[model samples]
Target: MRRVLDLAWLALLVFMAATWQFMPDLVGAPQQAMPRDQHMAVMLAVAVFGVWLTTRGALLVARLAPGLVNLPCRDHWLAPERREQTLADLGDRLAVLGLGLVLLFAGLHYRALQAAQPSWPQVPDIAWTAGGVALGLIFALWLLALMRRFGRLAPVTTPRPVRRSSRSRDLVWREVQPVWPLLVVLLPIGVGVGLGLFFRKADDHEAWLLTALPLLLTAALGRMVTEVHGDRLTWRFGWLPWPRWQVDLDEIVTAEPARSRWIEGWGIHVTSDGRLYNASGTQAVRLTLRDGRRLRLGTGEPRELLQLLKSRIAGD
Candidate 1:
């Protein structure tokens, strides 16, 4: 499929070049007489330019400075060991996008070129509008694949919880695993609402893409868990390990319930107080490191977690 796309892209480029040079000739008759819409012509040109700029520009950035490429789990991908492999992988994915756009625009241009000698046909405005929707869907799928692939930052031999012995166990707490019932019920409704809100006469079906957010959020954080194994305090959302956090309990100077304004929103974010790692609610346990930097961990049992943290920091 990929190779076929590459061949099609090459052929389309040749065809477009031919049309560009000999637009006055070699064109056939139109199916119907419609006035040439200047506005539509300009919009199509702009759309083509935009695609070239984005896809080709990304390819340029990858070649010159690979570090600038924003990647999920960037620390691992940009590391000296995996840098080349990461760049090559990303470049290929981007090429796929460029190919798709070329194929897409070429088809629209060809359809417009038909039935109009010396000038392009008066194609319906809806043709390019539909093309734009397809373009958006392609971009969304590209992003999903990129995130899912680079998001796994865990090492091959990464350790997990084993049989707990008296000396090994300190604390183990599971806050909440996202409920399938809740999502299964709420997602379709959310999507329906989103489509209702953002739907446009111009065929803007982009709102449906918003549904991917909740799905990704749930996949990323299926469960919220925190544990203290000896001196290290660790926490992670669900089974994904890249976004894990670890704190040195001995270095903690204070532990308390966190305070947050409504503006902070959710997820991992930096705030005036510190960094917040929240999955759902605003409730969290705040810890202040000796260096004055603070961090908050969202928790359901804040009182017990706070007490345990205080005792650990106090050398109990």
Candidate 2:
């Protein structure tokens, strides 16, 4: 059943790509009648609905053929360590798959550009480019959902310690330096800026791409700080006045030390089953919320931070 579903998904992806690539021919002349924003919104809605329906159909098939969809590791999700390992392995596999797809698309894009006629319409080029990006994002999200459905059934564990809430204290503050290795993210931004400057006279797209580089650089270089005040726990990056993330301490269901691989990278990101906010080291703390959402904060002093949070939660 799993293999069948996988093949079906692959076929669907191919179909979508082909449809997008040949849209100009299939739909006749391009229509710039609709505003770009409106057109993009409609396309996005259609893509989203298509993914949701495909996922729903896959689930229905699994329900109808439960015997075929059963996991090889029957009790794997029951063990915390095993579950984590399984998720991490899946993440690594997905990352490799994403990289390969990106490379494949890049090769195809290069070939298309090379074979293009001097007078070829730009509308088809834009359509094909947008379609490729949309397909990549949708496929990645679908794979993530598939993995989560397979592995996110682990039982909840006990919460870790947090510092006690003291009425006399206005706040509890803790800050750790982000991992130095995360700084490497700046390398790509530098390259992007250099290329953009070199091609400044070429197109408006280069200017737009350049304008976004600073924001990415800021996010990549931002520090992670955790602040606990009153009933709120806030996580912020850099000197940003507004918190990048915050949660009501009351909503926290569990907290524990969690490990991540270097490949997981840093900064705010979503996993198949949780959200990660890491700036540095692989060692961090994971928080499970009352609503089943998970958040991870990368920290160098995992034990100390965990104990403080545990005590705080107990005190509260």
Candidate 3:
């Protein structure tokens, strides 16, 4: 859904370049209606699809979960302490974006309606031209602003990090190799195949949806990664926006490897000991925090991750 809608908008912007070749009138005022489907598609794409970033990029499940909002620097803004504000702002941004969408479609819709009659004052082609651009900008800017604000935010408890050489900085980074539990990965594929077989006659969108679900799930569950940078630790299901987390390096009191029980299962779970961030398999490194909070960080390379933690904390 997100990809298709974005492609729809991309088509108009890319085609808008044709103003030089054909619709040159697009640039100036007395700004005329984009005669064909260009304007219509922009409005539809932005209004229908630009609902403050789907996959908030359309919640690709972003609104469904803010921690996993698909930002590489998610740890900075989506920290547990500030999460509520994020949800509130996300709601507000979407509400305002809704208004913008209303105006956007209204202008484009009016232009379409008036395209036939010359006497109808041309609705300034701004709607067809800059409307979508502005709305999309709003989406991008909101997130950029969020990341900007939080990235610079001084932690109340954590101390600031000092400068380090490139080599030393690299030492602080570790990849918690993600693995696919064969059964978990195959379950979706199996379901999708059964659905396809059952619904062999399903239409294009339905078929796409059926096929897409397993593929998406497979991708989301396929990889897990963890990293430490700038005195912060971050991790995610490789390539996904949710089911990820970050922590200030200063918060940790100790780090060590632990064996996850079969009963613990996988994914994010709150156990009696602490919250668990598991990708797959039984291997994980448990971190004891200054606040006495515990986290079982799932990793394929526990030694490297443990070393990375030591390097970061020791400021090596």
- Count of clashing pairs, candidate 1: 2
Predicted candidate 2 versus true structure: per-residue lDDT over 112-157, tens digit per residue: 4334333332335676677678777867775665466454465564
Quantify all predictions' global Cα lDDT against the true fold.
Answer: 0.62, 0.56, 0.60
* Per-residue lDDT of candidate 3, residues 93-165 (tens digit): 4444455555555554455445554443454676567867877886676556445434454334454344444
> lDDT winner among the candidates?
1
* Candidate 1 CA-lDDT value: 0.62
- The TM-scores, one per candidate, come to 0.40, 0.47, 0.44
Write the number of the candidate with greater lDDT, choosing between 1 and 3.
1
Task: Report the Cα lDDT for residue 145, model 2.
Answer: 56
lDDT of 3: 0.60
In angstroms, how far off is 135's CA in candidate 3? 35
State which candidate, 1 or 3, has the greater TM-score.
3
Off by over 4 Å in 2: 1-135, 138-169, 176-208, 216-221, 237-243, 291-293
lDDT of 1 by residue, 61-177 (tens): 755776787878877776777667676666666766777777667766656565444332344569768878888887786777677668877344323333223334455544553
- What are the RMSDs of all candidates, in order? 13.6, 10.8, 13.8
TM-score of 1: 0.40
